[model samples]
Structure formats: structure tokens, C-alpha cells
Target: MPSSSRSFDIAVVGAGICGLAHALAAARKGKRVVVIDRDAQANGASVRNFGFITVTGQQEGECWNRALRSRDIWAELSERAGIPILQRGLLTIARRPEARLVLEEFLATEMGRDCKLVEPSALSAYGDGLNGAAFAGALYSPHEVRVESREAIPLLAAYLEEQLGVTFLRQTVVHTAAPPRLDTNRGLIEAETIVVCPGDDFHTLHPERIAAYGLTRCKLHMMRARPARYDEKLPPVMSDLGLVRYLGYAERPAAAALRRRLEAEQGDQLANGIHLIVVRSADGSLVIGDSHHYAETPDPFAPESVDRLILDEYAEVFAGPLPEVSERWIGTYASAPDRLMLIDCPCDALRIVLITSGTGASTAFAIAEEVIGELYG
Candidate 1:
């Protein structure tokens, strides 16, 4: 049925981080904005990701600059929205000699200035009872920040509505027919501009459009820890594993020799889909993971073998005993064959953006700025 409705300056589909970022950008411009999502609760990669607003491992050039800018935006929003900033820095453990060498070289570049290499003796000041064998030393980056995503997303949604006057249509499914009309369970919504931020549900919305970009699904396994039994003095952290995966670090001449060595040493683990990232919650409990597996259809079940592989790496990094697991889950996100993000205009006025590189929390704000500028400018 044809319906009567009010119009908005811009209609953003998907209330995840990307859509929220777009809504925030449009509202800051004083444009009337409405966000539509199929779920009554906003749950997806936006909430499922590590919530680590990372700057250290971002591919150099445009990606790194965007992450740096988004970090600034996150700081501002966390204050205005009254969301808690869980941690203020990043501690990247380097267990392998080759990994330590990589950090040595990475610090020589302009991107590495915000960080410093610290020996194990200095680590005692941050936390107690670390596993001695986990790392000889680690790189500490002062530029990153972390928030509890499960809590942060809801807080951001409320802030957008209460503070920014942005409207939200929840539990609504939008069909991208002519003029991009949304047929919600509530009613029909017609808008001039539509921006889709489908995280992993690419097939549900616009599979054909995304398929041309070689977009495939990538799955990660993660576990949440029970609150720490001891004091909470450590900062948000990741393993030096990414230094080998991200070309920005691997491509450096100084890092190349070390990269080749670690690859050869850990070749079996890499082939079996194992990597490590250990982040902590506000109460001191740690969230550790994960492994990467690419498939057309990713299983939601968290395999025990994969979980063990992640834990084995953890055992190698820390000398102390491993934390008892509290909860485990799998997260899937759209990834492009190319290492960069994909933002394409399927129509003159319709924009589809995917964070094909798992950098949504890190880079979404800057990406939204570019999208809105092109549309409203």
C-alpha cells in the first residue's frame, strides 16, 4: 500500500557503527537524519568486534590517517555521550625473537613514534604475575583506546537520539526497490538518499553489488574472561601477530627479514588459522582470541581445536597460568580481497560502504565524512 510519511535529509540503513558514524556526521552538519535497522537490538560486528580503536596496526597511508582521526572522534564522543573509556593505551607482547626484531624496525617509521619498546622489567609496573615465557619484551603504544562494545553501542544509540535529535526506526526491514523505499513492519519510508552498512549480511541486502568487489565472509573466534581476581592496572593490548599480517609493517625493509623468519617458524599455526589478540574488560577480565577462516558460509559454532590453538599462543606469551574461560563466540564480517575498505556508489544517490578490513571501529568515522561530503556537497 502507498503510504503517507515525513521526509528526512538523509536515511541511514543499519544502526551498527558505520551507520551510527554516518548519522553522527550528518547530524553534526545539522541535517535531519533517520536510522533504520531490522533488529530491535543493534547487534552485529559493531558490537561483536574487539572494540579496540586501534592505530598501531592500521595499514599505512590513508587507512592510518583515518584511524588516527577516528581515534580523536571516539575520544570526543566518549566524553559527550558519557561512555566509559576502558583503557588508554596498547601493550603488544613480543614472545618470539623475530617478532621483537619486527617491532625494533617498526619503531623507526613515522607511524611508530607514539610507541616505545619496553623490557620485561618495566612491565611489572603495569601488572603482576605475567607469564615469563610469553614475551621477552613488548611494544607499548600510547595512541590507542578501548571501550566495552556491548555497553558502548547502546549508549551511542541513546546519545544520538537524545542529544543529536536523530530518529530511529527499529525492527524494520528495508527493501531497496525503486527510489529506495523501506517497507518496515511499521510502515513505508521513502528517502532521497540511502546508505547501507550491512556488516556480514551482505547477501540479504545487496549480494550482487558486493559480489563484484570480491567480498567474502571472514570469521573470527573470541572468548570473554571472568573479572580479574587481582588488581586492574594493565592497559588494552594486542599481540605482535598483526605486525606480520598487515603489509604496512611487513613491507618495511627493516621488518622484512624478521617477517620472513617468523612466517617460517609459525608457518604451521598460520596455515591452521591461528593468531592472537588479548583485550581486557573494565573489571579486569580479559577477552582473548582468535583465528581467521574465510568461507562463503561461516559456521557460528566456536570449534574447540581453534580455541585451543588461540590458548596455546596465549600460553606462549604469558608465563603465568591462563585465565578460565567464561564465554566464547564467533564473529563474521565482510572482507574484500583487497586489503582496503570498499565504498561504492551503486547509483547516483545511493551509497554502499563495507568495512572489508575489520577496521570499522577504527576507520568508520573518517569513511562517513567522505560519504556525506560527496552526497550533501
Candidate 2:
């Protein structure tokens, strides 16, 4: 159903954060850019789950650096785009001796320069709602930032259109992304370069290219709860499970003991891939999640047992009654064991990228810069 011909310097497929980042990066270089997405608006992994742009626990080298740069971009663009920073910083509460050792070892790395180790007795000095938990200590890092993804995604797209002059072809499916030619439902678009940031839908444009990477989707269950009494000042919280999950800490030699201990004691949690990441929105409601389940096509159902495992971990960290469940949902994103993200160069003028590590919000901007830089040069 292609119509009239259109042209731009860059044509980006997918309107999620990854696409938006690429659009911004190219637009900043003063290139005329058009972003194409199948949906009328962003409603995928980008807008789901916790919008926590984490830095401290990313895999130490490239991912950690990318998170750092992306965090700075988020701070700047969040203000320029009129998106509110609902919260800042991360609190990883270590409840086990092995977890505490992982944190200590993490602090010794160069990546932990500005982070601090908070003794359990003084955890309240950092934040409230953690008095009853029997925790060893906590690692507080100022490098993390949180945004209301559901709100931020639209605002960012609007900012790109109204302010940055990037064009958007919403509800348009890009059937092909070959350089100098794009076939879409609206019309045929011609661009000198093409960048496909397909969030998790690997089969849309270049299924063969994506299949070569051996990628799968990871499904997670997330929930929103309204506390009996709301607190506007709760920072994002993580727990021991995260220490053994996030690569920055998990990759450390010390994490082996933590994983062993976790497996022996919290088998269900480990089996379910449950970890706690609780953040609050501006509306006084908390965004909490999540448990990881992997499948090529994951079941859409949100199991109660998995939710209970998440809540039980939450109860252990925060002192108070569990918040009343207000919202529950599931999200799926690309996952690959060998890479945090995949950048496929089908040719010199084309790129296909996917953030397989669920760090799209945390690393997309920096990744965009890298991709755009290479394409332009």
C-alpha cells in the first residue's frame, strides 16, 4: 500500500527509546530524520516496567560506561523534553554475608567511584521504609535515575517532533529498511542511511539477520500498588537477588558464593528469576516488579505464585504492610546470553540493533551515539 515518495537523511524503524535515541542523535547532527513505528504510540517494553536507568550494577566495562553516559543524557533531555525525574539514585540492600561481600568487592572497582556503602544501622539516613528488614548493609550509588516511562516516552516523541524537527510515521509498519529505500504502509521513504531499533520484534524487517544472532524474548511480571499512605520521597530499592543477577556484581568472583547461598535458601526466587526493583511514581503509587521467564513466545499470563515471590522479597526489604494491588501486567523484551545488545551491519549504510539486556532505557542514548557516529563517519 505504498504511496508517494518521501526522503530523509535517516530513517529509523521503531519508536521506542532506542529509536528515539537514534532519531535524537541523528537529528542533533542536523540530519532530517523520520521515525517509523507500527503502533500509534509507544506501548512496548520501553513504556513498561520500572523506568530505572541503572548504572552501578551494569556489567562493569561497556554497559556500566554506557549507563553512565546515558544517565547524563536522560537528565539533560528529561528537562528539555519536559519529563519529570520522579526519583534519583539506587539503594541495593544486601541481606546476606555473601551479598555484602559482593557489594564490597564492587566498591573497589573504578566503576564505584562515587558510590557509598551504608551500614545497616544507618540505612534510614539514606531513605525510609527499611527499618524492620534484617539487612547486612547497602550500596548507595548516585548514578541512577528514574522516569515515568509511560509518560516520558510520549513526551520524548513529542519533543522530537515539535522541538527537534524529527518526523514520525506512527501506525506505519516498515516492511523493509534497506538503505536509500524503505517500504512502508504509508509510502516509500528514501534515506541515505537506515537504523532499525526493533525493541523485541525481531522478525519484522530483517528476520534472517536477527535469527543469526540467536535471540529470544524474556517475559517479566510487574505490578503497581497504592500504599494505604503514600510517600513522595521513596528512592528505588533493590535487594540481594539483584547482587547475584546484575552482571556488575554477579560477574565478580565473590558473587559465586552469593549465588550458592541464594540457591540454597531462596530456590523459588532463583528459579523464577525474581528480583526486587521498587520505584515510586509522581502519583504516590509505587511501580514494583518483576520476575524473569524466558521463552521464544512467553505466556501472557501473570502467575500469582511469581507475584507472591516478588512481594515476599519486597516485604523483606521494606517495613510496612504490602501495598494494595492497583495494577498488574507483563512485559517481554529481547534476551541474549552472549551479548547485552546486538548491532548487525547488514551493510555499511544500514544497521539493525536490539538491546537484549533489558537495559534499553539505561543504555540506548550512548548506543545511539555509537551507531550514528559510525554511520556518519
Candidate 3:
């Protein structure tokens, strides 16, 4: 069997970004923190994502505020953890006048304090090769940052282990998680407090408590493509379909009209939950994605038809020939019916935290800070 006795002040189960965030929070408090995960390396939605710490386009209220705090934490970690901030803003293009109307209403909100609308003529100033003349307008928000998630996740774990003095117990499964003691496949673990950050597999740990919330799984398709030449100055891009998906934009009253237009023209894409969020990587290739499909147990299949839908939207927003597709993969994350995230108090010493939305990268750190504060204070 593995080592029998290891104890800590806080034991964070799952080493994905959410668990790492909790580890960082507890470690920052000088608590003896140990993170346990079933995988030896980073995997799952945390690493299989765009790594965009987005502050704009988050549902207003707590989610938007948390994104702001989390974005700041990511910025600090860029230096402290040696992870690069690959891209640092968002450029959302409105392809229709209805979509442009939505952007106008969005800019009037408190959430749009620093963002501005770019006229079609000025869109080229941001970068080249965009189909600017075809766009109704664009919204520029200097509030998002992107990293290669595959690289950043592992580096964040290293920073916690090497710099923050946090301990990692990998390839270990905990069968039972009750604070002060845990029964694992490896051995026994002891911690004064426990935080379970199971990414999408709810039945594995605290299944009973998790089931009470009626959580499901969300499957998405993402790809990387090699463009012959991409504009280095262009920020990450999102298109009109995102208006009906991202709650921050969809919540705007004007979005109702845009949604109707999209329903008539792109019903197939909408049926498959397709939206466009294209971010750039350090290698000059582009990372494009992502269509959402939800189920109690999401299917593993990724149809090329879904990919074609995504590429069609990409074509509408860009001016050049399509980039050569390089890599593609599927990802799944825990999802809720009515909420973006939840922290369930199974008991006094244990908390079950899950980011039910895709906003884990954008909001996990701030949520971690809140959990740690309440537990210790």
C-alpha cells in the first residue's frame, strides 16, 4: 500500500485548476495544504480549455465580480508562477445590426465600465484580415487574458509544490472524505478541513450531496489550427452566436431580437449549442472552439458536423482562407440547471465546491479565497 500516515490542515481533493486554487488559498494562509488527485498529471476540463481568465461576458453580480478578482489573481500568478499571459483582451464582433444593438445595451451596464464599442471602420486598427466591413460593430473589453491551459495548469501545480510548500499526493483516490480523516485506495489521510473539487464526476465523491443539486455534465468540442499567417496584434475573438450563449450578453434586453434572427438563420448551430471563441497561442496557431452539449452523462463522440458549424462561423468573421486544422479534442465539465457554481456545505469541516459553468478558469481563484476565508475565520 502507499504511505499510511500523512496529515494536513486542508486537504484539497482534485488537482485541477479549482483544486489548485484552493491549495493556493490555504497555502497563502500558511496552512499545511495537501492536494490529492487520481491523475499523476493535469487532465480534464481544467487543462482541456482555452485558459481564458475572462472578466467581461460573465453573468452580472457575483460571477462578474468574482471574475474580476480571479483575473487579478491570474495576473499576479503570471509573474509568481512563471506562466505567460499569452493574450490580454477580448474582441467580440457583431455580424448583424441586431447583434450590434445587444453590444450597445451591454456597454451601458456597470459591467461595461472600461469597455468600448469599435466602429466597423476602426476594427482594422485592432488587427488585419478581419471582415470588418461586413460587421455591424465590435466590443473591445480589456479584461480577459489567455494562456495555454495545457502548460499553465502544470506550472501552477509546480508553483504550489516548489514555491508555496504545498504537498501533492497524485494517482490517489479517496473513497471517503470526512474531515479529520479520509479513507483512500492508497491509504489513510488526515486533514482538519476538506475541500472536494471534483471537476465533472459527481458520483465519485460526495455523490449523495452532489445529487441533491441535480448536476449534469457538459461536453464541448475545441480545436487548434495553423493559419498561414495570423495577426499578432489581434486579441481573442468571439462572434454573434456568443450573444445568445454568454449570460452577460444574452441577459441584455436587446439580445432577444438577435436570438430571433439567429434562430431563423442558424437554428442548426444553435441546436448543437455552438458559439465562437477563437484565441491565439504563442506558436502563432489559433485555438478555436467550442459547442456545448449537456446530459446527465455526456456522450464521448465528437461529430465533424459540429466542427463544420464552428468553422462556418469562423469564416463569417475572418477575411482569409480557413486555417489548416491541426488538433481537436473533447472536454466535459460539471454543470447545473440553474446556477453557474455552487459550494455545498455537506458538514461543518467539509465543503463540496464545483464550478457548474465553464467559468472555472475565470472565477475559481476568487471562489477559493472565499471558501478558505469562511473556513478559517
Candidate 4:
């Protein structure tokens, strides 16, 4: 059916996870929703990510709580949509004594209530191939879940359109979005409410409004590898690099000491914003990444040095020969210095939402529920 002639209760711009989340929220509320995006398929950060629905390492308070809620939604939706939950839980390795203190401190907090501290010798109980001798301890949190992003995005969209009856308009450029009517290259799309989830293209819908937040773009490197030997039992792996990157551990008082040690020992990794998050697919291939470099307009280049730094951290945690790098790519997301996300209101009927902290997979569903509750309730 042509969407131009039909009026919907809501129209969501963008087909990424954020947009799909809004579509699901509105449709569940019995709203006739149409989602419009410029791309013909799910691309951008949504598909390029590791699809890790992280809950344990998010910043404390709102971000952490939102992640918890979002993880539950992912579990529910995955089962309903027949999407595979490839892995569960997290292993945040503590590679130094200071890092161990940070994890111990984290375990004492409300966010870490359900998490436990894993000693070096006992770490293998969680999974094999962990370089335990290189670590002080580890933090195990059973709050995370992993999916193959490339596959799950399309599956989630299909479930929304087929089971929930949400309309999707791909390859449709929305020129002007001002609620009631979204002026698009295809045709005008009418709706009572509109939610725009522009991933990293801040200049598109409301440039001036988005500009007020001082948002920048963060470019990251990603890789797909086949390790010589990998334990299927291992949860997704992170390391000391993540303690400084993930706020749940970083914000603890003990993190200052850990950061100092990291600066002394891994300055290059810190300078490059390199962190380790290795998750596996059902086929035994690993999705690994990422380093953060922020700029208003990030370059399209994926440098070998950046990838080398990522692999350096990977080698310290996982044993056996280096994995065969089968594929590589780059991903970019919106970044704000002081906030994890933003919900900008241009009018009573329109909202512009962006996950500035690259946490869409971790927090999109919960954020969408909040927006929909405010818009409809």
C-alpha cells in the first residue's frame, strides 16, 4: 500500500533500532504508525554494532536503569520474533590490582548487586581460553544479552510489520519533519505524532535544534574473526579498558587509581579510546571492535593502527593463535560530552531522539517506552 495517501496515528523517521523501537511502542498502543527512512534497509550503527544489550557497565542511575529495562524488552522481543539470543552475561576482566579494586567497588554498589567477583583461577569456570594469569580478577554480570545485529535488525523489523502491522517506508527521504505532516521525497506522510531517530546525521531534520546540544560524531572500528579455538560457553568478554570506558565501573572512587595505572601501561589504547568487547555468533565467528574518535564529521577511513590496538587488547585476554580476520568495517554514532541521550521537542506533536553515547542497542527500547508514555499517556 502507498503510504502517501494514508494517515497514521504516528510517523517515525529512521528505520534503525531507535526508529523501530518507536514504531513498536506506538503500534502496541494501537496507533497506526508509519516509519520512514532514507535507506532501503537497516544500516548505520544499528546493524554495524555487536548487538550487545549491555546492562552491567552502563553509567549508574538513569542510564543503568534504562539498560536493565531495555534488556528485558530484548529478551521478550527476541523470543516473540524468533531472533536468536546468541549469548548472555558479561565477563569484565580485571587485568590489574587497581582494576580489581574497581570491580570490587562496583560489586558493592546497587548496580552490581547481582554481579560477582571472579578470581583469576576460577575465571575459567565461566569460560575457557581466558588468560587468567594476566588478570587480578573479573566481574561477572548475568544482565547482558547478545544478538547478531546484521540478522536481528531485519528480523525485528519484520516482526513489527507482520505481527504488529507497523508500516515501513524505505528509501524515502524525509525532507522536512514538523509533526502532523512529514514532507518526504516520496510524498507527504500524515500522522498525529512524529518521532525522529536520526542516528548520527545531526544536520538532517532539525539542524539548529540538534546543534544546541553540541553533539559530535564518534567513529569506531569493527572486525569479524574466526578464532583458532573459542569456547562456546564463554560470555561476551570485556577488559580493564572497558572499566575506564563503561561508567558503572569508571565512576567508582577506586576507578581513579585504575585509570592512572591504565594511563601508564596502555596510554596508546586510552589515547585511541580502545576498549574490548568480544561476542560470538552462532557460527563461532567473533564480532570484535571498537575505538572512539570524536569529530563533528568523522572521516570514513578505518586505519590499520587503530585495528592493531584493538587486537592487542584482544590477545591479552584470549589465548591461542590470533583469529583470522575475515571482515572489517567502521561505525559512527552521535556523541555528547555530558549526556548519554537526548529527547528534543520541537513541538507538542514531534520529538527528536538520539542516543548520544552509542547505547542504542542497550537502551533504545526503554527510551522509546518513555517517549511513548509521555506522548500518549
> Which is the leading candidate under lDDT?
3
Runs of candidate 4 with Cα error greater than 4 angstroms are: 2-5
Q: Write the per-residue lDDT of candidate 2 for residues 51-112, one digit (tens) a residue.
A: 99999899988999999999999999988999999999998999987899999999999988
All models, RMSD in angstroms:
2.3, 1.5, 1.1, 1.0
Kindly list the per-residue Cα lDDT of model 1 for residues 1-377, writing each as its tens digit.
22443467778889999999999998998988889898997888888888989888788888989999999999999999988888877777777676677777778888898789988778877666555445767888898888888898899999999999998988888766224465556676777777888777777667788888877888989898764353466776556566666665666664666666657776665765666777778777888877888987887777788888788777776555677898898888888887568887878778888898778998999999989988889
Name the lDDT value of residue 343 in candidate 2.
92
User: How many residue pairs clash in all the candidates, one count each?
Assistant: 6, 0, 0, 0
Clashing pairs in 3: none
Task: Provide the lDDT at 275 for model 1.
Answer: 64
Q: Report clash pairs, candidate 2.
A: none
Candidates arranged by lDDT, highest first: 3, 4, 2, 1
TM-score of each: 0.93, 0.97, 0.99, 0.99
| Pairs in clash, predicted candidate 1 | 131-318, 131-319, 131-320, 132-319, 134-317, 134-318
TM-score of 3: 0.99
Candidate 4 per-residue lDDT, tens place, 220-306, comes to 999999998899999999999999989988899999998998899999999999999999999999999899999998999999999
Score each candidate by Cα lDDT: 0.79, 0.91, 0.94, 0.93
| Candidate with the larger TM-score of 2 and 3 | 3
